[model samples]
Target: MFRFLRGLVLPEAACDEANNSSRYENLFKKLDVNEDGRVDIAELHAGLKALGIPLGKDAEETIFKTGDSNKDGQLDFEEFMQYLKDHEKKMKLAFKSLDKNNDGKIEASEIVQSLKILGINISEQQAEKILKSIDADGTMSVDWNEWRDHFLFNPATDIEEIIRYWKHSTVLDIGDSLTIPDEFTEEEKKSGQWWRQLLSGGVAGAVSRTGTAPLDRLKVMMQVHSSKSNKMNISSGLKQMVKEGGVRSLWRGNGVNVIKIAPETAIKFWAYEQYKKIFANEDGKIGTVERFVSGSLAGATAQTSIYPMEVLKTRLAVGKTGQYSGMFDCAKKIFKREGLKAFYKGYVPNILGIIPYAGIDLAVYEALKTAWLDHYASDSANPGVFVLLGCGTVSSTCGQLASYPLALIRTRMQAQALLEGAPQLNMVGLFQRIIANEGILGLYRGIGPNFMKVLPAVSISYVVYEKMKQNLGLA
Candidate 1:
């Protein structure tokens, strides 16, 4: 009976050692250029460079000298193994340095001080969060055993391995419905590669928006002219668009829509990261309210910066074939005719929608994630991919529902200039007129298409985003 139970339980410690050994062997082979069974200083330097590790000549020479035992100039396999063992010893010594009081346990304050020495400016709250993540025994601090167990099996010899380790171990709070990987090494942050985050986010946004472009254009059409004599439903909307400008018209304005994603995502992600630093509590943990405020402000920032493009997208989506040529032509005509203010026609309603959409999306996602973890997971393991997708779809739907009326009003305002004999209305005036003319249901004219696209759009965005990050070696 005991032997049967033993078979059921995995030998995690042994497996971890085997994984580390395999990684070491692969790295050694990579460094041994020409299969010469030895790694010279040049080979080591070349291998490190290939892995994107920035090392000066002096640093490379020093590393080679340290690894080359017995006064030899090259590292044989046994010498390479010894070098790794020495590295492990050095890491343990670094951990011991954090235990300033010689208590064999490292506290939050100690971690903070240690990182400060390495030029990492983190708050005490952040230190506590890091400690909590690794404090497996609920001790609130890492003992020697815990420290050794966590770090010994993850020896990173190059920048790529360090990045991989960081990605696997750290949890980032990006204040979005998606659970994106957001950890960056100190060097990466200092080098101003924050643009990588922007690139990944932009790609994700473009993919999601393009995948749902037809539904999006339909939504715009319905919002602007659904109550007019045309009486547009989804099928009639598609047919009318095709009849007007061919099937390609369904994707009109998509160029501007996709182009704005890079700047918008960059601004939003950068602003949210800055706001997180500002809102972190004494324990470095941001509460739900703080997260909501930050996310809303970030969305507003992105929207404001890209509002002109949004105006162009809306106009192109609803314009006739001869109305304007393309995005630049549309921009030139709008500027020549209506001036800069036309670009911000729907500014108020667009900003207003951000609060409800982001708030509801984040609140629902967190609540569902928490409930699932409580009921299903054993020890705070990450929820499955399908679970995350379900949560994202439900939360996104709720957010869309909460904010659809304002979105409709915004779309109408954006297209108001194109309609002959249409009266310009403020956000409140537009809301009142829509309700009075078309009834409450009128505000949700194209919501069927909107709802139909939300699930697949979000799922594809998240999956593609993760894969892109992995390909870029950021995840």
Candidate 2:
């Protein structure tokens, strides 16, 4: 991007350079913090953050590498001035792109149009709110100087990248989960921060799943076997499991369950990006419908690829000891007896459940985020760790509540579909049978165990992710 920006000589840059010298000097003084002749990484990072245009940890290093010609690890006045001028040139180009008519000013409509081109949809009011932040004179529009000053400290050369950062870092209280694909900046992708974030999240998820394996297995067991006559309460369920197998049986299916998370996340995120490009409108617009379809399709894509593992999970979770020695043995026997189709036993209901789960999860999370920003913006844009965990737990619970019946049906199919001479059921038929035979309450048979796991799972995942992010230099 900068290479393209470099090819164009700013026609007025040299002519107006002298007149802007003092402006550059004052800006340099402000960035230097201690009034020193040189600016360090700390000062630059702080300045950008304070201005609410933070470019993350990699930006400071990139700036020094490009502008710090002396290689002394600091940006002196000359280096600073040079960097700002080049940066301003790029910012000017971005401004012109948003200006649309080459009118030397940006209106809210243009802001909306530019964002749409970047595949982000926002109302005109949202665009106006954005403009107000940079519209220094309150004319409800932004001119060259306002745009330049607003982005002076930001290292992003493109307007889209800037918005990406703003969206993720501010009002960004999210737990580590595959409920939504994580968004990354171009810098994060290029500088390797994206993988660090993913790795952290993956590690967090593995630990969380492992930590909650017992409850997860119990949930599966309750979903499959718990009925009115032999009502499986928690204590009795625990006793029954330990009595049937050893204490270790509580974590029966967790290994395959945890192992599938990484590949599942990778596939989902990759599918989401591709779907965004394909589903974007002629004008590159992405509205809520696009987001919902993309997210649901991505979830389905991930579920499809890892569905064999999912079947294994449900089977192992509910399997009695010695029924199948392990995952591979189980898979081997199923392949031998039931053929390859057994691996995707519950795929129909599983796919159908993705829509409600994704929709409710995203809607709840977004509503919570907007509520947080409205009530707490003056206090801080970022929510605390506990609040984030709570929100994730609530949002996930809501999603699960809306789709738990399908989940129960999916589990039942995955576990019971292998029975000899049993009638197969599609998602619709499974829904009807479960409601008719087991009653509506049967749909939520395992909801207690499921709810019990959310808090601990989210807490463990969030804490591990935060620690990993810090270790990876993302904090």
Candidate 3:
């Protein structure tokens, strides 16, 4: 019985080896330009280029010398295999570097120091955050098993594979303790499942906005009335809103707000895909600059398409008692009273704010991700979820800081018509008026509530998005 089993297993193992040999032979053929059964420097360079891996002359020469195991000027099949084996050895060396003191575990301090060597400055707090992610035993360090498991699927190469892995999207690193869906297969993508994804995103948005509706309403109130005679503090604002409009009034404009999410998410994602295609190189890779440009343009496109809903949402939120019944009533009244342009009340500032917000957010997030990978992620390309959330929160906050004044201007303009005896001001006129009347601080009137909602809102949104993705079988 043992002999029979061995015979069966031996044939299967031989077949597997044959398949690997066939794959390597094909690669060798592709690299052998002159069909000489070996790869010279020129042929190797061309082969690497064809594989979307560009190397400088010095790097190429170094690789060629190392791969020429027989001391020949060219790389035969045996030498090429040696080069692949060297990659595995390099990965082991990288792990050893992280395993300082030869303890077979990497502590947070070691990670922090390693990142410093890579020119990535990180705080001890940030290092702890990263360790908390992959330290499965709550020991604040990564054992060999955990480290190997975390990076089992990642290519055993250097930063090149890291860059390629993150080239698509940074969704994985957007929230604390949230697990995004894995990368989609081409078959799943081409199967007309976009609507499902959009539906999931829209549902997540609605839930997040509704959960944070009170803060959002308070923000609008502060934006429109905090500088007025009302002098609305958070408590007074809540009391005033509740006394006048009842507790349910806190969600006044939430209908239109939720309604706009579907199209906005769908359009932004679709436009991003199109822009990526436009910006991709011949090898279908997009650099960081191209990714930022595509994201900014996509955001602008979505915001433009959904500007009317934004106007309606603000109007309904800041409207007086019984000013308009609902979304349609508000829309009709605005169209009749202020003309078609009313729907685009704050269009300019809104569009202008997109540039800084998207730019800063993308830049900070990418820098943080790259730094984490360089320092904390010894052999792994995946930074822990906590690291992503920390990076995302900081980046989003910075983006908000850079663009808050524009946001305040946009909000004020959206609610302008609702304010009694308020003069209509153009974008520049409004900035001047706010500066003159309330000082530059007027632009940050509701910023407290605005910031108050960021963490919970983002956390809830990401959690729901992941859950919905799973339910839809898209995860």
- Clashing residue pairs in candidate 2 are none
Candidate 2, residues 1-475, lDDT tens digits: the string is 1111112211123327785676667656767888878889999888655545466776677788778988899999998889888988888888888899888899989987887777666566656666766665669887787677666656787877667544643111122233657767666787887888888888888888888888888888888888887799778898999999989999898889878978988898899888877988786657667777887788788889999998898888877789899999989988988899989877887787777887887788767765665555432334455565556677778988898888888888888854557577776787787788888998999889888888787777778888888899877
Provide the lDDT at 111 for model 2: 83
What are the TM-scores, per candidate, against the unseen true structure? 0.68, 0.82, 0.65
Q: What is the lDDT of residue 124 in candidate 1?
A: 59
lDDT of 3 by residue, 78-172 (tens): 88766754654565566677777889888878876766554345566666665665555567787654553333224435533322333334342
lDDT of 1 by residue, 1-475 (tens): 1112122221124324566465456667877988989888788778766654435454465566667777778888877867766766765686677887888899989866765544343455555655665566677888755554444323443323322432222211111222222444454565444556556666777888787788888888888889845688999998999999998898898899888766776677778778877987775655546666776777788789989998999999999987888899999999999998999999898888887887787678767765775566543235566777677678778888898898888889999989999998899898899889888998888888788777667766777777766666455
lDDT for model 3 comes to 0.70
Q: List the global CA lDDT of all models.
A: 0.70, 0.75, 0.70
* TM-score, structure 2 vs. true: 0.82
Query: Sorted on lDDT, highest at the top, how do the candidates line up?
Result: 2, 3, 1
Q: Candidate 1 at residue 61, lDDT? A: 58
Q: Please list the residue runs of candidate 1 whose C-alpha ends up more than 4 Å from where it truly belongs after superposition.
A: 1-147, 155-194, 228-230, 277-288
Model 3 Cα displacement at 189 (Å)?
1.5
